[model samples]
Target chain A: MEEGKGEVKHMLLAKFKEEVSEQQIEDCIKQYANLVNLIPSMKSFRWGRDVSQENLHQGITHVFESTFESTQGVAEYLSHPDHEAYGNILRPLLEKAITVDYHPTPVQL
Target chain B: MEEGKGEVKHMLLAKFKEEVSEQQIEDCIKQYANLVNLIPSMKSFRWGRDVSQENLHQGITHVFESTFESTQGVAEYLSHPDHEAYGNILRPLLEKAITVDYHPTPVQL
Candidate 1:
């Protein structure tokens, strides 16, 4: 981790292919979330389906966020064998995947 | 809020226009974060610039996240006068803005 940079978050905005069944998407989500168990460095995970009323999503429909203690930890999770295996099941189903990693800085009042 | 739904999070993926100065972007971020103070229902706010090595951000360079207690709370923040005022400053600086709101569900390991 860079000095003074805190927890890193990996956020994925997924727009699955229209032909991919809902069941397939559910399985993909489960596999993606279960990486927390398979990889020790992944601190936590959460996911959500897009429910925005504003039409500004640009076709991204689901958001998955994973937290890590450091950027190095995130690197580990990204390259872990289990993650690669999960990607095999996930990558084909996605029409587009937008990933962004960042060191979260809280805005205090 | 929906019957079983918990907190709602608003995630924004922003790619600023090339001509927008860094100082202008910083001012926009400060103004966006300060909305937490002006709006009663906005629970918390945080932001980060992308540092992903996988090169899948789809041109989104920054992510800003805001949390609300309920979906209605998010709606209140969306329609709030203060947020609209801030958007006037932020919208023009962006080349693309992807907004997503979701009810966060933790993935228990």
Candidate 2:
């Protein structure tokens, strides 16, 4: 295993407000995608809408995953103006939001 | 946007037993990585240990993310023999487990 290759992954789970239209959610996702391009610390970003209908999710409707070079990189992304703007758009529409950040080490196979 | 390119992403949140050694958890991860290689439906797999110490996770310590071609692909991965074996090993170590599966559409920038 390579040394110091550890990276942080940020996962966000969100449930939208009942009044929020699907179009608005799509627009928010596009805005996030655009924000990723602007944030150098965000190495990658992906978002998805729940389709499994699984009870395990407890009504959480969407998941967003992003990678950063480290925990510091994650903090940088969080403090960036673009991220703040994105949150301003997203927070009002969210009924619930949960976030988890973790450091990933590659598993040897 | 590309037509019919939407993919399913499976996110798993887990907390290990208090008695479970870190080495055992690492071993389970490697086993899972091996299983992903054997399961054709699993396009990608990544796992991480919580580093953020944020209270939002409510003691959840690990996050795993995987991608498949579709929801059907996710089902195939879950039901596959290799996955079952991997779960057999992992379940015993897990104190809590939560999963969410979603379909991700590429956002137009």
Candidate 3:
């Protein structure tokens, strides 16, 4: 694929602190999802709570996956003022957070 | 959504041992991706390397995402012989692995 042309999946794995309430996490997720609307490059957003039977989550309870048309779109979303604002609301409640971005490659075999 | 009717994304985050060769990891990923073809419930497979500028990954180097039609489909995949076989090939090369599954919910806001 051409540079910055492939689809990128931005994955955020978060584990809320024990003291954080469910309502706060819910509110944080809602705002995080709204970034899709606030930033044009953020094409779509979806999220989920951990549901695996496998004891391999390493305490990460929430997974937020967002799609961008290209890496540039992700960079734009990352630096956008709205994301910064959302982070301010989210940072205090998190026990840990991990973010990964990639240009998804399809496997035919 | 009705029980087992929504889509489920199974995300695997892996960090290979320092001693593992690059080719070994590549082979492992290719085998993992091919599980889509081996297991009927595994609807699609895609993967990517960490490209995030942020240092939040906590050692996760690769992300493998597989989509299933429903939770039941994922349960079926978990017990499939092919996945078990793939696991045998993958587990030994990894220093750490985290797997999480979720039925992705769209954010309306």
Candidate 4:
């Protein structure tokens, strides 16, 4: 890794929305498909998958993945209007929310 | 908040661990009670509460809340031996993992 090369830092927020049907969530997943294309710094993206296969799931709902080239890049991504729009659309439906941030250190290959 | 008092930035990693019994996971919650006592910068902490009273809970397992005064503080907490040890114990059992990070902006209170 170059000594002055920039780093990858990302901040993630997760909220669990209630009373939303699978079809509605699926529709949002599809909506996100279009949203992802608009964000320049969304280096990685994915969603939550069912691990339990049981009919009941309590605390989990949406899972998302994204990456940024620098801390400022993350800031730019977060502050983007479209990104905030996604929040506006999703926030009203959530019952629980959790968030964490990570700065990925480069691995020596 | 002072002009440059510092900021809180935390990275959260969530994974759905499979084949882990509820009792074993509950035991872990007890173990973490001791671990949280060790990390000084952890300003906020809590666990996931069951939103659904149904028989099956598929995606959710453990919910952890932690806080850091600075990014470096978060780094210190993450690299702590106790935290690493927790990872050692829990990694093998995980089936799915999701991670996100957040930087809390100071709000006018």
Highest DockQ: give the candidate number: 3
* Better model by DockQ: candidate 2 vs candidate 4: 2
Colliding residue pairs in candidate 4: A11-B101, A12-B101, A100-B12, A100-B100, A100-B101, A100-B102, A101-B10, A101-B11, A101-B101, A101-B102
Q: lDDT tens string, model 3, A1-109?
A: 1213379988999899999888787788888888887999999988888888788998999889899998888889889999888888888888888898887887655
lDDT of 2 by residue, B1-109 (tens): 2323458778888889999987787777778778778999998877777766345786788888787888889888888999888888888898888789866544557
Question: For candidate 2, what is the DockQ-based docking class?
Answer: medium
Between the candidate structures 2 and 3, which one is better when assessed by lDDT?
A: 3
User: What's the TM-score of every candidate structure?
Assistant: 0.92, 0.81, 0.92, 0.43
Residue-level lDDT tens digits of model 1 in A23-85? 787777778888888999999888888988788987988888899998899889889999989
Model 1 error, position A81 (Å):
1.2
* Candidate 4: stretches off by over 4 Å: A1-15, A50-58, A106-109, B1-109
Q: Which candidate should be chosen as best, given TM-score against the real structure? A: 1
lDDT of each: 0.84, 0.78, 0.84, 0.49
Q: What pairs collide in candidate 2?
A: none
**Candidate 2, residue A89: how far the Cα is off, in Å:** 3.3
Model 1: lDDT to the true structure: 0.84
Tell me the spans in candidate 3 whose CA falls farther than 4 Å from its real position.
A1-5, B1-5
Question: After superposing candidate 1, which stretches have Cα over 4 Å from the reference?
Answer: A1-4, B1-4
Model 1: DockQ against the native? Answer: 0.57
Candidate no. 4 TM-score: 0.43
